[model samples]
Structures are given as C-alpha cells and as structure tokens.
Target: MRNVSRCGVVMLSVILSAGLASPAAAKEPSSEPEHVGVLDAAVESLTGDVYAEPSRWRPLSLGTLFTEGWDQAWASPTRGSGGAPRQGWIGAANGVFYRLGLAAYSYAHDVGDNGDEHAGTLTLYTPFSRRFELRHDIPFVVNNKGSGNSYHTNVGDFSIAPRVILSESQDFTQSFG
Candidate 1:
C-alpha cells in the first residue's frame, strides 16, 4: 500500500512537472493573459475548448464494456443538455449527463499487531436538470490483522448526495448539497 501511494505521488509529480515545463519550452507570447499556475492554465485551456464548441465535443465511451454497442454507454452528456457546466467547488463533472467513478484506498496500521485495511468505493452521478443532481456511493472494505492473519470483509455504509448549483459564471461556480 505504501509503495502504491508513493508511486501515485511520483506519477502526479511527473505530470505536473511536464505541464510546467511545456510553457517554458514554447517561449512564444500568447494573446491571453498569463495564468497563476500550470494547473490553472490547463483547466482554462480545456474548459475553453469544451465550452466554445459543444458540437465538436466527443463523449468518452468504454467500448462496450457496459453496453452492447460501441457508443451506447458511458457517453459524456452535452454541456447544454439540461444541466449546468458541471463545475464548482466540488470538482469538474467532466460531463453534465452522468458519470461513474471507482476509487480504492489502502492503509497499514501498527496499533497492536501489524494490520492492513483496504476499501473500494463505486460512485454514480446523475444530473436531473441544470439545478439538481443526485450522487450515490457504495463502498466495500477488507481488513487483515493479527499473527493468525485473519481477514474480515464487509460492505461499508452507502450514501447519497444531492447537489444544487447556486450560482455560476465565467469566473467561478458555487454549489452545495
């Protein structure tokens, strides 16, 4: 688990460094104002392209992983397709239509004997309209402990989050649940 965490950190650092180095390599001046950071610049570049030409945008698909056809499931919702920009303090929704996410976490503890814990969460987000969205999370957990190496597995608490977009603008977006 520690090694995995370390690897993730290293990968993130490499990606950020690469983005930061690109601006310096270009050297040419741009018409747009400078951004505060590489992440900010990247975000602006992506959102600008996405918002500017909605028709050109292609939905991401999983190639029949969850659906029968090539473009049936996992298609990104169009920006103006009955939902807001999908951006706010929560995070970029990437698509306003629907989204599915899976995340895993692991940890080692030394309380009495060396123990390890792992958890995986599956989340689904669906936007009903411009102002409202529903999110559900299901989690599973595993624990291993003691010299006997006993293992315990169980389902964690499931949760639902309802989000509302209060305000949105070119500068920022605000939302709450």
Candidate 2:
C-alpha cells in the first residue's frame, strides 16, 4: 500500500538521522563500569547520600535515618508466602509461556475429624520443549494433635507428572501423558 510505504520510508529516515546525529558507542566499556554509577558515587562522596533509592529499601542506621538517604536493601514482605503459605488454586493455559517455574503453596485437610493438617509444597514445572512438560512436587507436612499434646513434621512424598501438549491457545490447552 502507498500509505504503508510512506510510513516505512518516514520511519527509516528517522532512524537513520538519529544514528547519524548521535555519537558512536565505545568499543570498550568504561573502566568505572557505568556512567550514572560514577556520577552517583561522586554525589555520594560529596553529599554523603543519594537523591533517591529503589523502592523497598531501608535506611542503614537510625542515627542517619533522615540525614543519609535510604540506600540499604530490604526484602519485600509479599515476595513469597509471607511467612504463612497461601491456600489456593492457580491455573494457566497457552503458548510458550514461562519455560520453567518454582512455586510455594500450602494445603489443609478438609475431610473428617483430623488434627489441624497443613502442608507446605514446593511445585516445580519444567518444560523440555514446546510439547513436553514435567512437574515435581515436594512437600513438608505437619499435623498438630488437637489433644494439645503433640505435633508431627515430616518430609512428604514426591510426585512427577509428565505431560504432552497436543494444542495450546489463550482459552484452551489440551495435554495428556
């Protein structure tokens, strides 16, 4: 189409002009590793602090809380199960998606009278190819006697499920093995 041709030409010209106007990148990287990093180190030496830090970062010391910028690191509270594993179900279907995954989740016994039963399971999904996938589940389970007398913790059984994907789509994916 004429319009598509014109758009392509315009894009090509813009890209070529941008390349010509800008300085060429260095063949060798800087000894300092990074430019902005060097500037940050300079500023930190002169001011004893940085203008800002990444989110979830905590201050190094309370004495310098307000004086020194919060540059130290702190792990996020919601990163994992948040101390207590989540009790829920999750599912996904489609294309290449994530080739591998690691997840931690918990389950509870719902059947007849049983002491509080909880299990923390680490589920790993490994895809060997677009059509083949393998899954492994390792669990650490525990049961606390309602009698207020004892508790048990043990390494639960492991499982493996090999799947062969026949078709995959946004709404549907069929697999069997």
lDDT of 1 by residue, 1-177 (tens): 999999999999999999999988797444323323434433333333324333333332234223321221122224444565543233445223344455656676654565666667677665443334567877867556635677667888999888654543333434566
lDDT of model 1, residue 111:
41
- Which pairs clash in model 1? none
Candidate 2 lDDT tens digits, 32-61: 212233344334323432223212222122
Clashes of each: 0, 0
Each prediction's TM-score against the native? 0.42, 0.41
lDDT of each: 0.50, 0.44
